[model samples]
Target: VLESFGSRGQDLSTEELWQKVLQEVTAEELRAPLHRLCALQAGWWLADRRLGSITSLFCLLRQAEDTGRARCSQGENKLLYLLKAWQVPAEEASLPLVQSAEDLKETLCTSAAFLQGLLELEAENFPTAFSLLKEAAGGFCSKRVLAQIYTCLGCCAQRMGKPQTALQHLKQALQVDFQCLPALSHAAAVYHELRETDAELQALALLYEALEKNPPGATSSNPRFLMQTELLVCTPVLASLLRDRHPSEVKYLLAQRCLQDGRVADAVEHYLDVLTLLQEGPQQQVPLVGSSALPRIPEVFLEAASALEQAGRHQDAITVCEEVISRTTDLIPRMLRVEEELELPECPSPGEGLAGLSQKKENLRCLAWRAAGYLHQGWARAVLGESKEAITQFSRCLGDLLRVQLCGSGVGLTENPLPEVEVLQKIRLLSLIGRGTQFLELGKHKEALLDFQHGLQISPGDPAAISYLVLALWKLDRKKEAAAHWLKISQSPPREDEQVGRSFPLYLMSCLQQAVFPHRESLSSRLQDYL
Candidate 1:
């Protein structure tokens, strides 16, 4: 009788429940019901990122598992689960319980072999591990063997600048074991190299699954393990997104805390900002570890789209939707389309008023990803046009996203892969202001004005929020009153980056085209200079 709690591999946070499952597991319970969480190295060698020697740390854990470091299976299982949650998928994952001492040793050896190679490669000893893993793959070894084989090869190819080829091997690794750390790692790298950022983000979620805990206790005779966290997950590439840089680390840590506190949307925005900082190309104004091979351009594009869509910028949403659709023939395009449609005026409020049940039903295929796609599209659309469509798109995108954000998924779709305090703040601000912006675009000026006002309260001195308030008031025939708010934005710039700065140029250009605002050459020069 295994004494673990909850429903076996159905969840991740099962520490306490696993402790109870040691009572004794039945023969029937030895099959697919047994879920294991193994640890993959969170930190490893790359361009310029380090996390407390995470590679070596995982190696240490492997040693402990092999050498009988823990007396009881409970301790071993807990440690194993933590490791797996961290993204290391073991070959022995689906194996039955060890009935005898030798059986235990056999399992330990199998786990060790895979983990050893993982650590070696992560530690930058690719040549050494590759030779060994290759030798093992020749025999009828575990899927882990094949996973390591192809993944390592893919990584090598990626570093050598053969992205298309690297993608092939990486995909094979994933085929062998979707949750395999090496496979996921290489796949993420390859996707970024190929500019298939949507794929990269999805693969990244698998990395996070390794760290998640299974909830709900399982029924078992022996309480060897617990399954308190019912949300069984794939894995997450946590450390890959963060480097040793202080700002990056801080941002990621902040995002983690926010996620743990049940603020996922906020966390998503934080990471997006961080990703922007990370994606600023090699010649960034702020020095953060931005990689040449990183899919920063696509990632930033997606993040902006999401932010704008959430803020209800229909035109911005359309722009991102087009870009995403144009770039890939993958499922994301279909998903973004659903969001684009939902942004339409006749779609009704989030909870009621729409007759698009069939459309929503169709989107149910991959609601989470679809919701995420819409999130990106809305933000992008907001940037290209007036607030109306963008606002609607942003609202619908978020509504769909929140509707299916799996309780504790800790999901984020942003340029900044790491979430921090600033990211979370931005998320909240964006969510509120995005909704407000939608109202403004829809000609519900009073409603938009109120929403903007509320957003400003949350972010007291946010220049963007102030600008939004001004826009809302102006649309509501309160142009004279809105001037005071513009004073705030002119004096203090919130986001002065190219993306944020584009808003300034765009607004001026719009005014110039329509002759709505007055400004001769000298005045315009002053305006340009001030901006």
Candidate 2:
């Protein structure tokens, strides 16, 4: 019975062993067997986050004590003491029964100190908690418990404003038990407070890996009190830790870091993982820390497409753009007027107050989202040398942008323009430049000239627009005007060579390959000498 219930219990299913305990273990056998049973069950329950089950077991052990049939063993007593200490403040609960044996006295004293330290930690008494944990640290305990002790020590140090010392203790916790995740989480927080973006990213990446390695529900065979994560650390202090974020959110953060650091390929892979997780739908079981950290789903798709474009995966970029387009296209209204948006009903009328305002805002977002999709898809097609198809996409983008009309006297477009107006105007400029370049590619110089001049009116003195406009004039035999325009751009002091290289926009790059500009050097070089 001891072998089945105690030593080899983990090999059997929890339910199978539990059933055996119910059927075969007798009243006379209950004392020693009950200690083993509570010890084993406490570990499983704590690890599984089934704290209610542990409470029931605690009550059952208490009943055995009342009957004088069970002398709770030292390990069981320590487990109960820790669990009781973790509760929020009330009148102090009775301490677990201590054995009278001389050798066990020191061990029980150390365990008492650990429990006191936890209570002090919970009450935000950092100095007291730090002192008690230090006293407990010198005594013998299981490595996992020692890891928890170190983690608490780290937490106390952080509260005491000794972040570097806190980090040292957190590192020690990980060394004691490499799977100690609370230490990793606290370290990440410390790194964040220090403004160590790269270190924080590394720490968050490690924490994420540890979490994925042991999904919370996976029952482990070693059922020694698996310290509940919440119990092991203070909630309010390390509340901003990335551990609270869903794994997908963490991936999104990591991807943003990689992209910022110029690791485009790595960013692309991480973004793909995020998109896959999102497509599987929200994981209701895992609490998302906050949705504020994530971009909206369509925005994330657009970011991924941009990253893919930067990585030179033009076809993949186009496909992602298509995904955004297909999803949001139906949501966009056929036309949007700024006047209707501004005049949303102030008083509640059947479907008309906040709901009406929200629907209008959503429609505006959908319009912007679909227009962005066409812009990206058109740019990708231009990159792939598909001039006619690219022109079609660019025209479609312009058609969407043109639907947003500025109407009504109090629109305040000049002083406080609506978001949709800003988005529409920006996209309109890009779409015009894009289609104009495509027009240049097909030798339609007059049409290309009109598009470039119109884009210049929207964003006057835009370097790319000026450059394309010059090219269009040069193509149309207006040499003196083209040279004058080129000279105006050259008068601005040159930026860094890398900046100059990138200053030429993506849409205009296709214009460089046009048959009209066939020369020994690139268009920028041709423009330099054209005067």
Candidate 3:
């Protein structure tokens, strides 16, 4: 009955209705379609008016979970029917059942069981989750689902602190599906944590090599692995990894990382390379095409501006910031379009809803992420000594953030982000430190002190920061108090990997050593003076 809603009548198709529901496009927009679907379902009495609400709808879906827990049964097809009824999207896909058949609508044995285990594992019901998924190991199913089962088992074992068990599961998972991205990622992480450094690097390299290929297929063999590697490693540490990779977006990264590593000349070359690429590409278009549209500013001009700004060209910096901001309208849209296209889930149908769940406000989340990029970019500008310009950038980003909130999604633009409050606090602390440094550099000693004090309050006793505070106090001529602060810095020794900062403590000790034992210096020099 639901499938009859094409060009024939007011009847709506099940898949289309499901797609729309999964999207959670505001119900107001769904009014007409809702009226029709409701009439048809009501006529058939499958509408389940009692499950009008999302949470209640979830309870109805829980039957699928129950079937998995019961080791698979007749209720499997009923679950798919419920999924259609709920109108979930295919790509933001419903949980796969334990693949009793190629057509999931017929049975939910294989993927269904894995889905149950995944949820249970997440909830820390390790043993139970493990038991549920392992049921399909010997059963007929896709190697992909089988790979997931092994990975889940590995993670569960790792959480239980059973190293051997975890490794065993990882080996099994990899054997089942060598290209399983999640399995590889988790296996690498676990290997690193367990001190299997060689294995860890090997796994990391495997993922990187796979990502470099940009695999051509509906699945891309593991999109998360590719996207996440860029997010996790490429932007942070594995900077050398970018050398052999795509030279387009890579130049910006090289410039940024070079700045991070204090290699100014390397940064200059790469930034120049980016300019060369941009100059040769179409520079006049509204939405610049391809990798050349990066930075949304003329690379030559901006790179020159960056070089000048870093060399204390405040006015020249402002000129660059202004020009880039002006030209950004055309460039930013291009870059943003690229990002949006990347975000689009597999060949999205004209009106399909694309969230893990239909009603989760995922569109709002995606928008928020774009706005966050602006907010972070503003902060980057502020740190590079573009004071007034940074404020404007920050203001613009904050405004965009506010716009996201007003648009009314399930979440709001918060100082604290979802699922990770600790991380937000750390970011806020870093912001405080940045502000403190700005104040210090600009000769606002009192303001700098306040910012430092607040940063200390947020993250008490961090030696790097505490050392900076002590230096600030000493420079401000509070030697006695500052010396005491230095003592606190000395008590916590540097980690083995970071041996450079031990000098600050040593400097303080030398001063104190001289004061405490003024007569002792003569022992080492006794040959000349004592004779």
Candidate 4:
């Protein structure tokens, strides 16, 4: 009859075979076969699928026990054991007495506590769950059972807002079984909550690997396989969870991970998704858990453009930069109008109103973003060897930045209103460096010297600007000035320790040597040795 239920590849369904067996088998004969069926159903229950068969098997076993079958005691004990583990509302009077002589009594007790803990956890009674699960974990002898127990404890700790303890439990669970999906997933959530992005990604990477290795349909016994298939079956639930949890940030982090791993194309796609979510406005915005603000949209767009440039997609980088520029331009006119209106006699408060102050600061931010866009555009042009066009872009960037500085100065705002002062300074320095390099390439040595001098004034320790200044002075026939600059460069901090790379200095020295004295190999060798 069990073979007819497909135990040995019979064609009949379980329900059909069971009905036929019910007609022929007495309660005594049915107990053994029924126990076998319940064991099979229990495996499905562990995998968290097909509860119907498990429920039916439990009912059949209960019927045999109630009918006073002589040999049904073992089957009755098995049913009680499973009920305790499942946290079913079984009558204590009907529960089979724990046989002290049984070899597996401890295991049965541990399993019961673990399942009851899981039930409490499902009901959101975390403290009780924690206590019960902890006790269960102490009694577990099997590594697999212990791993599950620890994972439940971790879940309880996490719910109780004890992330550190939760992480410890999760780590123990993983140590017991590296492929434990529940532990890995919970670890990822805990690390994310702790703002340990790198650790979160590490856990997620392991989880993904486990999912791939134990794909659904490979086997039903592996819980992860069942979970993976269920996740695919109910994608909307997954989507809802992702939507509520600020998936944009997760996508951004994943993009950063992909970029770090040299998966540039994947990073680009993820970055684009982040930008799309931002552009869709506040309704589409998912509030960051434990954070008050979303990521700055302009900064994200700039980063995306940079990633595109790194992937050698120059045109795409330029397009993104142009979008930033256009967006900033559109806001500038509105901000200027607001500023003008605030200055009008009709507005008694002037800049005292919060709205006015906010608009003013936003104007400054837009100007800074515009300058940044130009700086990025200049870099793209420079990388493509368009020196003249690059010079134009750099000049525009410097002009915009100077205007921003002038506006800040005129506002009687002793401090920089925008929190992007450092960013503005970086863009200014890059503009100077780019323009200086272009001027040197165009043989406008004096102009190059002036740009380099301005850059050095902004950042005295900058090696690239200093090296370029020396070359520019030399080309202009200022021998004394060139020698003094060379001495200064030599006395400056070691180039190796500076943020600028050695290649810039090497290239500058090579160009100077070729342009001034191509035949003076001895002089060039001395310069190389000094470098």
Best candidate (score: TM-score): 2
Off by over 4 Å in 1: 1-119, 122-124, 130-151, 156-189, 194-431, 434-447, 460-464, 475-481, 491-494, 497-531
lDDT of 2 at 338: 69
Q: Could you give candidate 3's per-residue lDDT for residues 229-253 as a string of tens digits?
A: 1121111111211112233443454
RMSD of 4: 15.6
> Which has the better lDDT: candidate 1, or candidate 3?
3
Against the true structure, what is each candidate's TM-score?
0.29, 0.58, 0.34, 0.50
- Candidate 1, residues 1-531, lDDT tens digits: the string is 232433453353333333334223334334223223112112111112232243344444444334444333452333233333232223354556533223222333333333444455566675654543443344333564456556656765565567887788778877886545546655665676676656765665555444232111211233232211011111222224221122333343333333333344665565555555555554332333454223223333444444344444446545654554344324322322223122236546776644554444334433433333444444455556646655665566545444332122232222222122123223345555666766755677888777677666655755556656766665666655666555645566445432342221110111112212222344335335444
Worst 10 residues of 4 by lDDT: 502-511
Worst ten in a row by lDDT for model 1 = 227-236
- Over the full model, what C-alpha lDDT does candidate 3 score relative to the true structure? 0.45
- Which candidate, 2 or 4, would have the higher lDDT against the true structure? 2
| Ranking of predictions according to lDDT | 2, 4, 3, 1
lDDT (10s digit) by residue, model 4, range 1-531? 545444442576865555455444555544544444444444445344344554555555455355443332542334334444332222235545332112133443454455556666777788877887786787734566677677778878988999999999989998997656667777877887887777877776666556556642333333422212222112222222112224455566666666555567877887787788677677556564443224556766777876777777867877898988887777764224222222324454765667766666667668777877787777778778898988898898887776643333423222322234444565676679778878888899889999989987776756667767777777887767767777766677665542332112110111121122122344335455554
